[model samples]
Target chain A: MQPEIQPAPSPASLAREDDVLEAAVRWRAEGKAVALATVLETWGSAPRPVGSHLVIDDTGNFLGSVSGGCVEGAVVTEAMDVIDSGKPRTLEFGVADEAAWRVGLSCGGAIRVYVERID
Target chain B: MDLALLTALNTERAARRAAVVVTHLASGVQRLVRGEDITSDPLAGDIEAAVRAGRSGVAGEGEARVFLNVHVPPARMVVVGAVHISQALAPMARATGYDVTIVDPRTAFATAERFPDTPVIAEWPDKALPGLALDPFTAMVALTHDPKIDEPALEAALKAGCFYVGALGSRRTHAKRMERLAALGLPQAQLARIHAPIGLDIGAANPPEIAVAILGQVIGALRKPAPAREAAA
Candidate 1:
């Protein structure tokens, strides 16, 4: 609880919930479309743990991460769709998926990410 | 997706308050539930369990599936002593995902040169630890053999209910220290929280090895719940 030295605030670093949530707040206040993709669950050798986030603006700009670098490209792409459709999409990717190697989730794990538009 | 909800959530985060952001996927609805408010939540049981474990996950099924994004404050380690053992333990704690702080009133020992890239507060633990707001997410270690320093810190740590309290000493030294603490009117149950003769009995003979043992025990205490004891009168 000691407010000591703030660690590195990178998405790939220790999960900084404040930074990501604050970014979402900033994006909304700016009137830009925002989508929040949260790692709902993980199985096997997932890179990032559950509750990780990747907040994406309509412009494809993002902060934080749900699956490290793996599957983020696909998530961002789906996030854009969610923004347009004003809907939520749950994306599941795994080693068994044909696109797993392409998306770099080749760590022999599966992850479910729920992407929802937050206007 | 409510702006008011997001605003409230950010406010709590700024205050370092524990909360869980429950997002219902199908309807794209989300609500921020704080610690005290969880009991009233429909998902109270799930949220409480998640809060206790400090983890977040999906709960329910089908359209009712909700993502419980837990927002507990980061775990911290407050090492009270700027000795070589502290120099070794601080970074190890940081590597293991703890916000590490070194507290020692001796400015010469608690120098930035000795512990770079970490906060070193030159204040007594009784004064400094209270301001740190030690909680269950925090672990405190007293490496200074001086009872004047270590005892005050241990008292503050135990009173604050830190997840782990460890003091460096031999069995005989701990007994003597306990006698002193007992004189201070701290009950036996409270003193039981201290893991004196500190660390797992790993036969560590050097500073670095002892540091490893300490971190190992701290991690064990954090990861595993303490054994149940008889209820206090």
Candidate 2:
């Protein structure tokens, strides 16, 4: 009988940031459309650091987080558009922006995110 | 965000090498810069500064806008003894974002029950360290006080060019260690990199306090520029 093959485990040495990039590459290899969002800059008590990443697939699935669960929904929504249009976009969220209030960055901080399709 | 570039970046990361992604926000044009290749890049100065500080952010303004996404391997700490100090040190190191591993040949001291969530390797340093792949981003600490165990690990850390190499001992103990290491044919210059009488002289009265001092010294070695000889490579 053919031996059952177990899926390889991710190395314990990989940091959380590395996992996001690794996920992006793995998704692309599977022929899934992917978009990557990165926190470009932050002001005040931002939920995540500037280099934090959130990767989204065409099916609205995501790995990693770009915020304290406050703004990921909006970022993922914007990322689907980026995947469909193949055009990069910059998004801003903060208590200062009225629209952001609806989504709520209730942490009273501002962040700029860059979203791009991974072709 | 080219697939080729993304794959290359992931490959570098998996190998624990540093890399930077320079993205032109306006045009969505991006390129990956390997750490070893940074000195030859056009933005060498700015990128080098960012890499040293371990930060990533936007650079340039308006029409020339770009984002420098720096990816340095997470710093690791390999403690050479699973002693009382290590029990306190491991949790503290983890809280500060360091991946901590404890190595000791004494199975009595290297128990998982003692280390809890941390990795404990009950093997001699000579056998265990070679597989760890010590690198510039790693910090090694020898707390065993036993020459047989600690010396081999210290030698490995020095040869690997680990950013920090510290040992717990008094000044006299270190002086004796230096002579023995030199007798083993290790150059005096290389032996000098070991921070004997380890940790800052902060008058630590207990294991936990000493752990703080040692952690502080490790952070200082990481953040501050080292002397010319150590930085030569």
What's the i-RMS of each model? Answer: 4.4, 1.9
Model 1: residues with Cα > 4 Å off, grouped in runs: A1-18, A95-109, B24-31, B36-53, B60-65, B175-189, B226-233
Note the residue pairs that clash in candidate 2. Answer: none
Q: Is the docking of candidate 1 incorrect, acceptable, medium or high quality?
A: acceptable
Per-prediction TM-score to the true structure, in the order listed: 0.79, 0.90
Top candidate by lDDT: 2
* Residues B1-233, model 2: lDDT tens digits: 89999888977887788899999888889999999999999988888878877999888889898899999999999999999999999999999889999999999999999999999999999999998999999999999999999999999999999989999999999999998889989998788789879887799999999999899888878766556324521
lDDT of 1: 0.86
Model 1: per-residue Cα lDDT over B30-69, one tens digit each: 8899977998999998997787678999889998988899
Backbone clashes in model 2:
0
Alpha-carbon deviation at B208 in model 2, angstroms: 2.2
> Residue by residue across A12-106, what tens digits does model 1's lDDT show?
32324448878898889789999888898999989898988899999999999888888999999999999999878889999888886788897
